[model samples]
Target: MMPVDANVKKIIAQPLTAEAFQKYGQVVSVPRGDDGQSANNNTAKRFNFLGNVQNLRSDAKANMCVFRCQPVAMPFHMRMLEKHQYSNQMFSPMNAQRYLVIVSLGGDEPDLQTLAAFVADGTQAINYNAGCWHHPMIALDTTIDFTCFVHENGTKDDCTVTQTKEQFFVHI
Candidate 1:
């Protein structure tokens, strides 16, 4: 029973596959702008420790949307601890809100679907595993600031388990 010190030579991020994460959540790509800017609006505004904002809406027809941030980020190196590997902790959803990880850093593209490789423009992209550990930003060009959209449901186990670390590589 001792603490293990490891070196993180690199940060790996890869496209989340339905096969790898079966019964888990789906990976939907955020729409990008045409030739230049971002097309999707609704991105959250970062306020920091200043305060927290919570919005819960139920219009009966519109669709119940939930956005919650633990204010957590990807550490320098992501490693699977012993705790997460044994229990069903590896997979299990805190809530049932559909999430969307939108990026505005440089030219990194979203994994709209496929294995999700950036079109290769120098910019970096990121993919989240419902809640499986991920390195916030792939870091290729600009800062990686994102707003995650999650759902609000009594659904206890929304995340499924897999047997691999986050896999990401440059296409260029």
Candidate 2:
């Protein structure tokens, strides 16, 4: 862990909306009505190609993972932010539960002043663009399971973590 800075920023979580979240990534939610039919003859709502699922180098490969995350209480202090330089990351909730999504513009490093927070219901998921800075999983209310997609290889280039000079607290 890094040393905490003297500055603290308070962030109020707002309702997640497609328009607001577009800059960071796509908001993946089940579309209304049946858009397509799967081979099983069931109604299917597909959100395709939400993000760039590729490795930074040709030698690496992308993989899918299931994460069971415990819920974090409100007024949680955010100490660090991370980004995947190689591939885009996607998170889809396996259960219907509300959660918090915090993000900042992608760059060589994270800018605390640009941090934004959004509250997402179980119906909503997100595909963070490559290099997008974001806080780690922040499940709320109850424990939740998420299906994650990203490049996986034993390399430090996969993810980068930066400690903030100023602390931020997320409130719902």
Candidate 3:
């Protein structure tokens, strides 16, 4: 609600885990269990129901994309955040060392006080819930490619962007 200030909030990203990220999204990874059944004639393991996709609009269709993200320097300054009001966005790392995921809890805009950051490895993936406020995917150390999935109707409402009241610096 106010103009951006000079004060910078510092956040140290913690390891990404299901319990820690439950309120904002679901972490997609290999489930720990022998529940996975053998597939392809005992050559591969198949785990079902890892996560669900959220598409709340009737006219919207699922869209899959690949994003090649460049490495970001340490103490990354975060000035803006975005959210998909009608569909959940998922990103699966193809080849990444470690990446940062920043999110917040708010109604109309991001609440700086509620900002949280997490570091996810290449083996881990995440699916942000619809309307969840989050910073754009941040690649650290090396360039990474991600397979993303979301729903879109070819309109501005597909994604909502908002400027933060204060800049936040993300530190690993």
TM-scores for the candidates:
0.24, 0.87, 0.93
> How many pairs of residues collide in each model?
5, 0, 0
Model 1 vs. true fold: TM: 0.24
RMSD (Å) per prediction? 14.0, 3.1, 3.1
Q: Compared with the true structure, what per-residue lDDT tens digits does model 2 show for residues 1-172?
A: 3334556678998999888998888788765563643644455445455455556777667788988989987788888999988788999999989999999995887876778999999999888888889998899999999999988576898889999767888888
* Model 3 steric clash pairs: none
Q: How many Å off is the CA of 156 in candidate 3? A: 0.6
Candidate 2 has a TM-score of 0.87
Cα deviation of 18, candidate 1, in Å: 7.2
Report the error of model 2 at residue 30, Å: 1.8
Q: List the residue pairs that clash in candidate 2.
A: none
Clashes of 2: 0
What ranges in model 2 sit over 4 Å off?
1-6, 32-39, 42-54
Q: Distance from true position, residue 145, model 1, in Å?
A: 3.1
Q: How accurate is candidate 2 locally (lDDT)?
A: 0.83
Top candidate, metric lDDT: 3
